[model samples]
Target: MSDRWQEMTVFVRVADSGNLSRAARELNLSQPSVSRIIGALEARLGTTLLLRTTRSISLTEAGSLYLERARYLLAEMEEAEQAARGIDSLHGVVRLAMPVLYGTRAVIPALATFLPRHPELRVEIVMSDARQNLIADGVDIAIRLGVGLLDDSAFGARKLAFVERLVVAAPAYLLAFSAPDNPADLARHSCIVQHGLFGRESWRFTHDQTVTSVDVQAKLWINSAPGVLAAAVAGLGIALATRVMAGEELRTGQLIQLLQPYRLDPAEVYAVFPAGPRPSAKVRAVVDHLEVALNTPS
Candidate 1:
């Protein structure tokens, strides 16, 4: 049983590390020994769990399923050990990943109340628009705002909110220049483009079950959502923004929604964590707090 547990632990580390040598070094085991243990386990199971290459290793279909179960088992084992040792308190740092603007507007404010209650728990926030490798980056929880999940098997996600993208501009700008009557009219206006994965110059809109793409001309190209909001509020140009990102501006009439007849694709907000057994207490606490805070009226 101890040997089985060791094999499970080693396999998990190898999966997480994505390199046998790195996993071996971290486990304080020889490379050959780690390789042999994995080989032995694969042979015993009569299936290949990982596909190895010269530079990297990846899980097979069977491997992915087995990995999920293995993580659950390991987590349960760890919980059992912690319980036996009487370490019931939730403490230690949880590394969280999220987009910068959303983290600033939604996540940080939520944690203001949450952090005070859990005096022993610390949190490290990784704010970026780029997709982060959860295992490589050691992220404990990730908050994603997007149309859908990129990889469902990799993490367990809980839906926090449904968000919408809005094409908006400062009321002053709209008064100075004619507002776009439709998606195509954006070509004649100065558009603030977000040059990222969502596309810089191309904006998509849907109406009456019809979808259209507009090749927008941008006088300003910004990578950050906050920057886009700031520029729009300053009456520089029109911008595409998420409702949550511009919630305050919209509420205070600093920005007005444009082309209301057409709608951009709605995005879902999710709190994701590594696929395993139930999440640790600290993870659950933060996720729970975010769920309520984000879902509440802004």
Candidate 2:
């Protein structure tokens, strides 16, 4: 059975590399040992899988079909091994990436309490509004705000929360400018615009089955969502912001919601990680903890 598994591994390597010598080098085995494994596999399967030549080796028709199944079986075995190990212990540094506002307003609270429970684990949170490549950036997990899942086949993305957006301005600002009665009124009002990773000025809203857009003429363009809120608080201009971020300000009357009848759909927040069979224990724990924290009533 051990030899059979070895043969399968060798067969997979050969199929992948397209040559026995290259596969042997990758597996740290001698050329003859690699060739013998393939020979044994072909004998067991009662078929020739490779066409060897002086210049190179190519897969036979049967080998081409078998290669895909072989890869799947190997991946499953690896996942089974990881799952067995996960039941015992989970300890590692988990690198996380997310937009600044969500990281500050939502994710931080969950991580603050979660980290204390697991002393052996370290969590690194990178707060940026930019969309980062998960694999290139070495991010174990990411939290993104949007309507649909990110189109990353290489990763697993799950919706974690819905965040409502609100147009808010200080009472003084509202009194000075007179709140906009409708979306069209925003054109006459000086608005504080947010220039996030997506862009500087486009915002969408819906009211009574009718969609309206305000092309905001900005007096101030800030790079961060929090910065835009701050501008609104200081009575600079009206700001469209997430309720998750502006909730305290609205409650305190520092900011009042404008165009209350026309509200934008809350941006969907997703917890994403590299797609795989068994998510790492550390990653799973963090995800579970975050859901609990975010869902709990404040």
Against the true structure, what is each candidate's TM-score? 0.71, 0.67
Candidate models: Cα lDDT each: 0.83, 0.76
Error of 2 at 148 (Å): 5.1
The per-residue C-alpha lDDT of model 2 at residue 291 equals: 80
Candidate 1 — which residues are off by over 4 angstroms?
1-70, 78-88, 200-213, 218-220, 251-253, 276-278
Residues 211-292 of candidate 2 have per-residue lDDT tens digits of: 8766877889888877887889999998878787888898999999988899876777778875332355677788888887
Worst 10-residue lDDT window, candidate 1 = 81-90
- In Å, residue 142's CA in model 1 sits off its true spot by 1.2
lDDT of candidate 1 over 1-298, digit per residue (tens): 4878888988988898788887787678999999999998899899999999998899999898888889788778767754764533556678899988888888898888788877777898999877778776657788887664546575777888877899999988998999999999999999897645344587889999999999998999887777888999999999988887898999999999999999988777888876442776668778988889988886
